[model samples]
Target chain A: MWAFTLRRLLYAVPVLLGVSMLVFALIHLAPGDVVDILVPPEVPKEIADSLRQRFHLDEQLYVQYVAWLGRLMVGDFGVSFFTGRPVAEELFGALGNTLVLALPAAVLGFLLGIALGALAAYNHGTWLDKLFSATAIIGVSLPHYWVGIVLVAIFAVVLNLLPAQGMGFEGLPTSWEHVQHLVLPVVTLSLIPMGVISRLVRANVLEILSQEFVGTLHAKGLFSRRVLYHTLKNAAPSALALMGLQFGYLLGGSILVETVFNWPGSGGLMNLAIFRRDVPVLSATIVVLAAIFVVINILVDVLQALLDPRMRR
Target chain B: MSQVLANLPRATEPVVSVEDLHVRFLLREATVAAINGVSFDLEAGQVLGILGESGSGKSVTLRSLMRLLPPARTRTEGRIRIAGHEITAMDETALRHVRGAKVAMIFQEPMVALDPVFTIGVQIAETIVRHEGISYSAANQRALELLEMVQIPSAARRLKSYPHEMSGGMRQRAMIALALSCRPTVLLADEPTTALDVTVQIQIILLLRQLQQELGMAVIFVTHDVGVAIEVADRIAVMYAGRFVEVGPTEKVIDTPAHPYTAALLTSTVLGSTFGRRLEAIPGTPPDLRALPAGCSFAPRCRHAQDRCRVHMPPEAVLAPGRITRCVRVADGELDLGSPNLSERSIAKP
Candidate 1:
């Protein structure tokens, strides 16, 4: 089992390397950069030359890529072009901020999804099933940013219940005062995942319920609840596989949601870097997000193997 | 040990009895009459083999004994009394105690029948814990003993292995061990050996017979193989469509089948000495269960179907003593098929 985990981790290395290369290349391949904003309509050529030389934009694309990759290996993300702030510091703070919202939202969404899915699947054709199914469909289908705007309009604007946007604190949310700033963003971020996870869980539970062993369990005189336990255990591995991917999506896909709330997360950071043409901050955020995604994939594989003995090989 | 003491006063009463059981599967467009009207009584320590091809309602009959049919669309009617518990009358909660405690079933394919995620020991022990209310450790010990009883090698180690890790035959052994764990009064085996290798098939049959005798438990063994039925059964019930056409002592039924359907079934198998005795082959397929004829279900396939035979279902005609056949032609004694003690007369002529 340890060997399986190790092998999966090893497999992830190449994928992450590929993602790093792409993040670097794709960001650099864009049309404009800090150079465009830095230079005026008719600046002195030597001043522009000094700016280009300082950031090494004057170097060949391969040299720039190799240099960036080399520095990245040693944990240096370079300084931000607009603010002259260290990219790593800015990136980590944004990641921590994202974690505060995404983590709780994920927890809420996942737990609710699993509960609703199991209930709906066991009940199958009743009104409860239809109600939950409709909820899940609406969740997955709706635009989350639009949902966020409506949430802000109702709670912050109309009811005067909660603060509208931004992290109340400078960093991670710890106290309740800072946490209230979380309501709209977390709810907006969670809707799509709740819908996605619940649907996956429902389908898996329904499929497992029909397997032949469920009849065997029934024949064994197991209580209906006991039979349900067996059904859920079998259903878990597949549901968990999707949950892992959804977790990655929750963190990475919360960009627009974060933008609407004005929350300081990687999504917000990337948004700022994109407009200002801050290549260092942009490259660092994308690579870090891509790396997090790869790690999630590995964790899902290992967790699935643990749950299902058949996957040990 | 506990079974023998309980068997004294109830030895005369059949361990399992079903009367006029009917099963119908209600689909969107049609209602499938899976089991029309089947009746049987199996006493303690006896094995009644139900022989039939697919869709003959044999498996459906076995499942009906436990009320295992889906409650949504499938309807099961009539009395099923196993170990003195009225199966059809019991509610879901009451049925649980009677299910693994009084009546248990082994399925056709062990790999499919056994829970794949759980270890064999866990599956077996859970049953003991559920019905017997024993401690988990005690249940585990009993589970180990059961695996050994089923002749599983390295029993202790094998207990921890998942179903997929074991061979087909071993998994079936695990299945049997699990079935017998709660010491049910009767066991319903639905083609238990059908998915095993041919060589393993005999071994499982022998093991079942030996266990049944040792435990003195009644068993309703459902199978498609003629040899398997004859090998394990004292009495044989040959089913056609949804009802039993003939049921008698194994020797009597095989040597001189009173019903034409039974005769066709016997001749179709490539058994020793019974080979090339294909006097008549069954024609066409089983009737679409959704649209069964009003009269005898086998009339279309039977060569001796008279106009009357096509008009009314045959009554269960008792020839002598325990021999019963569902065929109108049997009443006339012109069956050319067989009469009671026909095997003796045919032997004497030779």
Candidate 2:
């Protein structure tokens, strides 16, 4: 197993390299220049040229790529256009902020979704099943941004229950304050995934409940609750597979929710950089997100292998 | 022979008795009468075989005895007394107590009937623990004993193996072991060997017969194969269109079949069909129960049917001791029933 894990880790290297190249090329191809945005329009043409050369923007695209790739090999990700801070440094802060929203939301959504799914599936054809299934359908259909706005309007504006924007109480520690601020955005982002996860789990459980083995268990005089839980355990592998794929989707969807909520995450950084035409920051952020996505895929593969040994062969 | 008759398990009462048992399946669009006024008795240690075509309600009848039919579509409308208890009227809680302890079922497809996620031992032990209030360790020990009794090779090692890891025959054995774990008074085997190979089918049949004798448990063996019926059943009930056409001692039913449907089934056994001889076949399929004939269900397919046969249902005629057959012609002595047993008399190719 360790050997297989080591092989999987080795395989991730090429995947990361491929993602880096694609992100690098796509960012370069997009019609915008950090130099054009950095220097003012009123500045003299000669000084602008001098500024461009100074920032190494005057080099050919290939030469620039080579230089950038060289820096990337040495753990340098250039600098942000507006802030003039190293891209890697900004990414670290942005990633930390992003997790503050997405991670808790993912965890919270999974727990609630699984419980609801089990209940709905066990009580299938009853009012509880219909109620929870309808809620999930409505939740999945609503956009995260729209949900965030509505939540803010109701809780922050009209009700005065929670603050609308920014992370946490001002006087408290960073982590605690950030955690408090995370609630609304996390909920907004998690609603869609929660609905999806629950529906998937419910469908899987319901399918398994009809299997002959379940009938055997019932005939064996197992209590209804015990039979339900037993079916859930048998149905878990399918649910876990669904959850693994959904986690990757949740990571991507979090960007939109984070931007809408103004939660100071990687997504917020990307949105700001897009407006200012900060190529280095945008390219670095995309690469980082892509890297995270690749890692998640690898994790999912490993989990499937571990859970079902037949897959290893 | 007198000593053998004396050694038979006869307690002056049947372990299970069904009287005028009717099972109806209320489908989405219409109601299907699967079992129509079927009645039978299973004495302790006696193996009763129910032989029929697919959808003849033989399985439905057995399921009704256990009250194991799907709740939404199925409804039982007659008395089912198992070990002198009216099981048909019992509440769900009361039924659960009687289900695994007093009566148990082994399904057709053993592969699908055993839970895949759990080890075979866990599943077998669960039946004992669930109904008997036994500890896990005690249940496990009993489970091993049950497995060994079924002739599962390496019972201890096999206990840890999941259903998917076992072969078809082994899985069937494990399923039988599970049914026997609770030491029930009756075992309802629903086409237990239908999904197995010919040799494995014979092996399971022999095993079941041996176990039933050793344990003195009445087994209601449901199957479509007449060969299997002849092998295991002391008495046979032949069914068609949710009603019994004939029932008697296995030898009597196979030899002197009184009903035309039973005659058709016996003659159409497809003994040499593989050699491309269209061995005399039954004329038509069993009628749809939703729109059954006003009189006899088999009248449409019966070549011996008269106007009266189509106009009125035939009642069961007591042919002789331990023999009964449902046929209008038989009451009139229009058909003779002195034929010899086919399986017992026919010679097989070497």
Candidate 3:
């Protein structure tokens, strides 16, 4: 198992390097000049030229990439052009904020998905199954940003029940105040993934229910609850994989929900960097998200291997 | 009537009695009558082999005894009594106690019959704990004993081995051990050896017979192979189109098959007396359950099927004290089951 994990980590290096290179290239290719955006029109040409040279923007693309790669290898993410703060420091801060919002949403989504999916499978063709399935379809279909706006309109503007936007009051995170601000954004971000996971789990559970082992368990005279437990245990590996993938997706792609809620997460930070042409912070954030996604996929593979004996080899 | 009931033999009471079992599968496209008026009584320690081709409702009849069919999709009307307990009338909770305690079943595909994730010991021990109300340790001990009973080698270590780790025969032995774990009075084996190799099939059959005698459990073994049925069963019930066409003692049924279908089945056996000649294959497939003819289900394929046979289903005729056959030709004395020695060579040696 340790060997498998080590091999997976080794395999991830090239993927991360490839992702870093892609992000760098894509950011560079975009129709924007970071130096021009940073320097005002009134600034002298020499000062702007000096700023470009200082940031290595005047160098060849490959040279800039190599320089960035060297700094990244040494844990030195260059300073953000807009903020003048170290990119790693700013990225980590944004990442921490993102995790605060994403973690609860991911956990809640996974638990609810499994519960709802199991209920749907147990009920099978009943009215409850239909209801859950219909709700899942709606959840999957509706865009998160649209859902967030609608929720804000209902809960914030109309009812004034909950805070509609941002992480906390005055950006000072407090438990109660943070929760008050979290509800809408978390719900919006979680909905789509919850729907997807529920569907995946439902399908897997239904298939497991029809397995010959389930019939054998029934013939053993186990209570329906125990039979369900066995069924869920057998179905768990695939569902867990889906959950990990969904978590990785939620972490990397909750951009729209964060934007709609103005939650101070990496997604919003990335949005701000893109707008302000903060290339270093943007590239660094992308690399971190990609690394996280790769790590999560590896974790899921290991988890599946552990759960299913057939996959141990 | 009460006096007649009182006069009935006490020692001969059936452990498993199924009466007029009618199983209908209600699909959206069609309603299939899988088991049509099937009835039988299984005595203690007696092995009754149900022989039939695929789709003959052999498995369905066995499952019905356990009430294992899907409630919504299947419509079953019958009296299924296991050791005098009316299983059909019992609700889920009551049925749970009856299953694996009073009655247990082992299936055809041993590879899939046991959960892949759980070890053989855990699976068997779980049944024991549920039915026996024993601790996990006691159940595990009993599981080890059962594996020993099934003649599995390295019984103690095998308890920890997963189902996939065992060979096909070993897995089947484990499955049988699981079935016998609760010491059920009635064991329903649904084509248990069909998925096994020929050599393994014989070993399992012998093992089952040995276990049946030792445990004194009524065994209802379902199989498609007539040779196997003759080897394992004391009495054989030959089924066709969801109904038993012939049922009698193994020797009597094989020697003097009263139904044309039974005669055809015996003749089709490769080990039969006419081995050197071209085998007599049953001409057509079993009829579709949904669109079965109003008459005898086997009339289309029967060589002696008369015009009357086409219009009316045959009522079962009592050929002897313990033998019954479902065929109009039996009444006319027109059917002749070839030779007794046809299956004698293939029957398992005592």
- For all predicted structures, in order, the TM-scores are 0.94, 0.89, 0.93
RMSD of each: 3.3, 3.9, 4.5
- What would the per-residue lDDT of candidate 2 be over residues B1-350, giving only the tens digit for each residue? 11332377577889999888888889879989888888888788888899999999988888788888888668888888998778988998888888878898999998888877778998888878888888999999999999999999999999988888899999999999999988889999999999999999999999998888788888899999988898888889999888877889877787778788877787677631234334567788789988789888999888888888888778877888657778878867887754533443344423
What's the true lDDT of residue A21 in model 2?
A: 82
What's the C-alpha lDDT at position B287 in model 1?
87
lDDT of 3: 0.86
- The 10-residue segment of model 1 chain A with minimum total lDDT is A32-41
Ranking 1 against 2 by lDDT, winner: 1
How many steric clashes between backbone atoms does each model show? 0, 0, 0
Best by TM-score: 1
Compose the digit string of candidate 1's lDDT tens values, residues B173-212. 9999999999988999999999999999989988998898
lDDT of each: 0.86, 0.81, 0.86
TM-score of chain A of 3: 0.94
Better of 1 and 2 by DockQ: 1
Top DockQ hit: 1
